[model samples]
Target: MAEAGWYPDPAGGEGYRYWDGDRWSAQTQLRPGGTSAAPGAGHDPSTPIVVKGSSDDDEDEPRAGLWSQVKGPVVIIAIVLVTIIALIWALMQLGVLGNRGPGPSNPTEFCPAVTDGNYSVDPHPRDGRVYGGELSYPQLGAPWSAPTVDGRVPFGRDVQTQTITIEQNYRPGQNWVASVLVGELIDGDGFQSPEAGMDMVARCIVGAFYGDSPVQREDVTRRPMVVDGREAFMLEMHLSFDVRGLQAKGETAIIIIVNTSGSKNSIYYASIPDNAQQYLPTARDLVNQLRVGG
Candidate 1:
C-alpha cells in the first residue's frame, strides 16, 4: 500500500510482496527459511529487495516451453506437406499428369515399320488440331486413305470416334475393306488417369456401334499390352456398324487403350474382314507399334 512499494510478504512467505499502485499482483520473492511477515509489518523501504533475475525473463520460460512441445508436430506436418508437393511435381514432370501446355515436353514417337510386301507403313504424329496432346500412330499405307470422320460426327455431342478407312482399292472397287477407329470422349475438363481416359473412349465407340443397331459385340476379350514401355489395355471383340446406310461386318476387331492421365488417353482400334485374315498379322503388328508419347 505504501505507494506501490515492496511490503511484507502477505502469503506468509519469507520473501517480500510487490504491490502495484492499484492491486496486489502475484509478484513475490522467497526468503531462506524465514516466514512471511504480516501485512503492514516492518520492512525497510530504503533497502529495495532486488530479485536476481528479471520478472519478464522468468515469465517467458513457460511460454517458450509450451512452444517447444508443439514444435515437433508442427515440423512433422510441414515435412509431410513438402513431400506431397514434391511427389506431385515429379508426376507432372513425367507427364503422368496431363501436359500443361500445347503438347508434351517431348514429341511423340511411333512404332517402326513392321509390314510385309502386301502392306505399307506410314508413321507420323496425328494432326494437333484433332487432339492437343502428343500422338503418333501407324497408318497402313496406300489402300488406307488418311483417317476421315464417318457420317456427320458431332464429336462431343452424339458420339466420339477417329475413323480410319482401309480398302483394297482406293475407290470404285471395294475389294479388301477394313476400318481402324480410335474412339474416346475428351471433355473440356480433361482426365487424370490414363485408364479412365481409355474407358471413356471405349464407351464412346461401343455406344456408337450398339445404339439402334442389330449387331452386338461378340467374342469379347480383355488383356494387357505394352505401348512405349507403358502398360495398355486391349479389348478384342467382333462387331459391325452401318457406314452410310451400308452395314459393314467384321470379325476379330480390337481396341487398345492407354491411360495417360485422368483427362487424356489413347485408343488404338481396328476392325478387319474375316476373309482378309491374311492382313490380320500385319494389322496386329501395326497395333503393337502404337505409342502414346515419347
Candidate 2:
C-alpha cells in the first residue's frame, strides 16, 4: 500500500491513499493547503504532509483571541495571591502568631481578694511576680503556702506577662521536692504562656539533668506530690557525679519528673539512699492526707 500511489497513514490521520483513478496515476497530492496539486510537480508521493491556512494569499491580521481576553483575569489572580502573602508576612512581622503574643494570664487569677477563699496570696518576694493564689486547694491539701514562682512573675497586668523561675530544695529522704515553678496556665486556649507553669520547667529540668544519661533499673525512682492543691507526680535519679567538666566519681544525681494530673494519684522516689527506695509510697500517703480544696 505504501508503494502504491496513495499511501496508508502510519500516523493515523486519514486512511489509505491510492492511485487517484489510473491514467494520472499516483495517489493524491495536496497543495500547500489540501487543495489537489497538479498531476506531478516533482512532489514526493510518500511524504507525510499538512495543509497550511486555506485563506487567500493576502489576508489581514485576525483580532485578538480568547486567550488574550483571559490575560487580565490571570494577572488579577496573581496580584490577589501576592497581596494575601504580603498580609500574612506583615502580620508575622508584627508578632501576631509568633512567640510574641499576649503573655499568660496573671499568676494570681483567682486570688483571695477576688473570692472569699481560705487561700492567701503572697509574692515570692521577687520582682516581676504577679498574682499568686496560695491556698491549700482543699482537693490536694489545705492551709498550704503557695508562693509566686522563685522570681520574675507577672508584674504588669495587661498584654505581655510571664513568670519564670527554678527552685530546687528537693528532699529525697522525704520524697519531697521543694520546687519553685514559674509560669502560668491560661484559662482559654493554648494561648497562655508556659512560664510559671510546671510542665515546661520540669521537662526542661529533666531534660537538662538526666537526658541521655544512664539510669540503672534499680536506681529508678518515681514519687507523688500535691502541687498548689492539685494532684502531682515526681521522679529522682542517682546520677554519677561530675563537676568542672571532670568526672567526679559518684552516682549521677537527677530528679526525673513527677506528674499528677489525677485525683488520689501516688508518686514514688527518695533522695536518701536508705529512704530513696522507700520514698514514693510514704510521700503519697502524706499527700493523701493533704486537704486540697481549702
Candidate 3:
C-alpha cells in the first residue's frame, strides 16, 4: 500500500518482502523490470529482471517512518528473556541468592585412611525413650588424620549452641543407604530412601539408630575424632517448612546430630561435616560436653 526503503534479502522466505521505505526488490525475477507480463503471453520464463538505481536527488531524503516492521515486538521479547537469565546468573555469583547456612562443606579431599582397629560408635545424648543396641563398623586401624588441612568446615553463631550436638551424632542405616542407591532426595526428604534423603541433619543420625544390621562402613564422610579410636561425622541441616530456608523468626540455625556404631557405642564429630564448620566447636561443647550453671 505504501512505499518502502530497504534492500531485498535473497535468503529470506517466499513473500518475505522487507520495507526499504521506497520500492520493491526481488532476487529471482519472472520478467524484466520485476513486472510479470500478464502471465498469458508465450514469454520467456528465465528473463533477467534488472533493477534501476533510485534517481532521487542525493541531498533530498524522506522522513523516518512510524515503526519498523523488520525488528518487531517478538524479536524484542526474545532479547529481553536472554537479558533476564544473564542477570540471575550474575546475581548468584555476587552472593545475592545465597541462603545456605553458614558452614563449610565436607572436606572431600580428606580421606580417613582405613586400618584395622576399633571403629564403630554413636555420639548422641542419652535417649531414654528409644531402645536399640549399638552398631559397630568392623574396624579401621589408627584413625586417619587429615594429612594437610585444606579448608575447614564453617558454622554460624548463636544458632550453634544447642543444635550442633544433634548434627554431630547422626548415622545412616544400611537400608537407608541402600534406598539412596535407587532414587534421589529431590524434595530434600530423600525421595526414594528416607536415609538417602533425610528430613534434616538431626534425622540423618536418628534414622540410622536401629536399622542396618552389621554396620558396614565407618561414618567417615566428614567425621572428626570423638574418642582415641573412633572417627565420626556430624551434619547440620538448615530446615524450614518450605522455601529451602528458615524465613520468619530468623531461625537460621543447625541441628548438630551425630551417631556411630562402634565397640562401646556413641561417637562425636569433634567438628561437624557442615557448611558452618566455623561455629561447630562451640556448638558441640555447649550441646554435648558443656556443664551448665555454677
Q: Give the top-scoring candidate (lDDT).
A: 1
Poorly placed runs, candidate 1 (over 4 Å): 1-133, 147-177, 181-200, 240-249
Tens digit per residue, CA lDDT, model 2, 60-133: 22334555778899999999999999998877654344542212111233221212221223343333222222
Compute the lDDT of residue 148 as modeled in candidate 1. 53
Against the unseen true structure, what C-alpha lDDT does each candidate score? 0.49, 0.32, 0.27
Candidate 3 has what TM-score? 0.21
Could you give candidate 1's per-residue lDDT for residues 191-250 as a string of tens digits?
354444443444445554334444434436667666676556776666554433343454
Q: Give one digit per residue, the lDDT tens place, for model 3 in 1-294.
A: 544322244466443333333433433332233232222143332344433534343223332232454458869889999999899877765434455421222222222222221121224234221111221111111222211111111110111111222222133321110000000011222223223222233333222321222211122223233422333333433322211221221112222222222221221222233344454444334334311111
* Residue 114, candidate 3: C-alpha displacement in angstroms: 34
Residue 146 in candidate 3 has what lDDT? 15
* Clash count, candidate 2: 40
